[model samples]
Target: MSNEMIKCTNVSFKYIKDSEGDKKEKYAVKDVNLEVKNGEFLVILGHNGSGKSTMAKHMNALVIPTEGTVVVDGLDTKEPKNVWDIRSKAGMVFQNPDNQLVATIVEEDVAFGPENLGVEPSQIRVRVDESLEKVGMSKYKRHAPHLLSGGQKQRVAIAGILAIQPECIIFDEPTAMLDPIGRKEVLKTIKELNKKHGITIILITHYMDEAAQADRIIVMDGGSVKMEGTPKEIFPRVEHMKKIGLDVPQVTELAYELKKAGIDINEKILNVDEMVNELCQLK
Candidate 1:
């Protein structure tokens, strides 16, 4: 029993550099098939140029599939008439918070999306307040957007997207620009949105630790899915990930090391506590 929120079937994309030259178009993604269930927290992992961002763009109709289809909540993204609806259904939060915030004040910025959609002023106020509360930025609603911290700015950006009442959100390296604390703040907000509010999350990140928090992880290599599984299933195979230019979580690596040193530990460790418990049980 799966509630499919997003589905990609035989999807592929190629950026044509030359229409008549010998260079076949640059393939960003190829024959990619994925299904994200409603309320699921899915993470997409890949190195730079591995096609993760390209796929993220597809979720919101920022980029259409050159072949096959990307359907979000039953709306085909390629449909010209459904473009606006598709974008609304799958809101986006990009890597930089600075670029996303357009208005000077936080509340006004949050209201931008709803305003673009022609939502009434009274209703927009309610959504803006609620969205800020969801991201723990309610108090900052009246503050100037530029005065907020990097984390705060990012949350406000997320609030802007949430203000639109989207069914799903696709984060394209959303925490890449923040400090460690800022990153934590943004991650916490995202996790709460998925766990408490049941907002579907599609997180694209290079940080293995961040990916470990997801319900499922899909590894991309050469614009195709190389591995797909839970963090426990994916991180244990350190060799495989290393071969693809990705790193396993630190705790997972530590557990693997201990196992190699003749310690009796299960190789798949996602966090420090799990590694500690495994060591405590050693023979």
Candidate 2:
């Protein structure tokens, strides 16, 4: 079996707009090529309209490329026959939890995916319980989704996807609409899914801290991928990231400022702990 889970070959996508009397094409993703390995934690960072979400949609076959191909787990997303299979293997969680929930009760929402996939009723019950437990929402299994906190709702939304038993998941700005607390909850769940469950994670986020947790990061800009590297490599290029309208992690930015003031701190420091260690060394 191949370790590669998703691959995009020279992918390009453009949206068509009807002008005053004619059609105009505006490219959202342009000639991008990338590969995601099975069980890898990858983050895509981009400003608004930078095409990160568009690329994510291709993985789930929600959108087809205008000029290239996207293949997920040996299934070609461009092929109509493989669309459902690709979606089943690579589930997606969007920005709004409310939009993803399909049932009144938490457990029912979680079971929705497996039920649609024709999983036996008994197995579906098992999956719903297991998925809710994984997301730390088992206690709220019978609660109404709409009455739950934003963070709780988001966790339930994630549970829905988990019930499908996907090999990979694409999260498109899942925390954008979340409060800080909610963001923390969702991010923790995402990390657990990737680390504990060994599921492939392709997280599309503008949050620098979230991107820092990724094994590898891809920076997108103006419909093209501008940079790709590990977090340590990507965050240290502070000025370049700013030029492209992205911010580095808070600690990284602090380190960069300290370096400018002639302090002997590593500009690559990504977190408070790393900064503390470096500062202690100078003591």
Candidate 3:
């Protein structure tokens, strides 16, 4: 069996021109080809208007490609018959948690997905419990979603998708609205989902720190993938990243500067601990 969970082949998307005088078509994404392995944690980094979110939306058929194909779990997203199946297998979590939650109560919100799929009520109950537990939101099952913190509400939103038993989840700036604490919580939860639950994670973010935690990183620029590699490999190309209007992790940037100044520190330093250890060795 193929290990690939999501595949985009020469995909491109163009929004229709508005009836009010705009004539030229604008492509949000352009001939982007990518593949996501099952259970892998993949991070996508790009500046605003780089089409990262637009690329993510194609994973679950939320936006069909204007050219080529998006195949999720071997189902082509462009096929009308495959739309629901593809969506069920590849769930999406957007920027705002508030926009995703539909029920007043947390568990009910989680149950909504499975219920729509015609899952039995008893099965829905099991799924709701399991999904909430996976996201560490089990204790808030009966709590009103509005009363929860941003992170907690996002967990509820994730649980709602988990209830549908998706093989992969596309997170489009899931932590963009979050505080540092909330960001940590959501990031940890998603990592656990990818590591323990064996779910593929495709995270779109502007956070360099978050990208550093991924198994692989894809850097997008001008609606196409400009670079793709492991964090250690990607972060070291500091100048190249900057040229595309993106930054590396803070420590990595510091290490890069030090390297330029004739210091023997590694340019691949991704975190404070690594930087500290490298500097200590230099001493």
How much is 44 displaced in model 3, in angstroms? 1.0
Cα-based lDDT for every prediction: 0.94, 0.94, 0.94
lDDT of 3: 0.94
Per-residue lDDT tens digits for candidate 3, residues 13-132, read 998777678777889999999999989999999999999999999999889999989999999988899999998999999999999999888888999999999999999999999999
lDDT of 1 by residue, 1-283 (tens): 3489899999999997766666667899999999999999999999998999999999989999999899899989999999999888899999999999999889999999999999999999999999999999999888999999999999999999999999899999999999999999999999999999999999999988899999999999999999999999999999899999999999998888878998778998899888788878876
Badly placed stretches (over 4 Å) of model 1 are: 18-24
Candidate 2 ranges with C-alpha deviation above 4 Å: none
Which digits, one per residue and each the tens of the lDDT, describe model 2 over residues 117-172? Answer: 99999999999999999999999999999999888898999899999999999999
**Estimated TM-score per prediction?**
0.97, 0.98, 0.98
lDDT, model 2: 0.94
**TM-score (C-alpha) between model 2 and the true structure:** 0.98
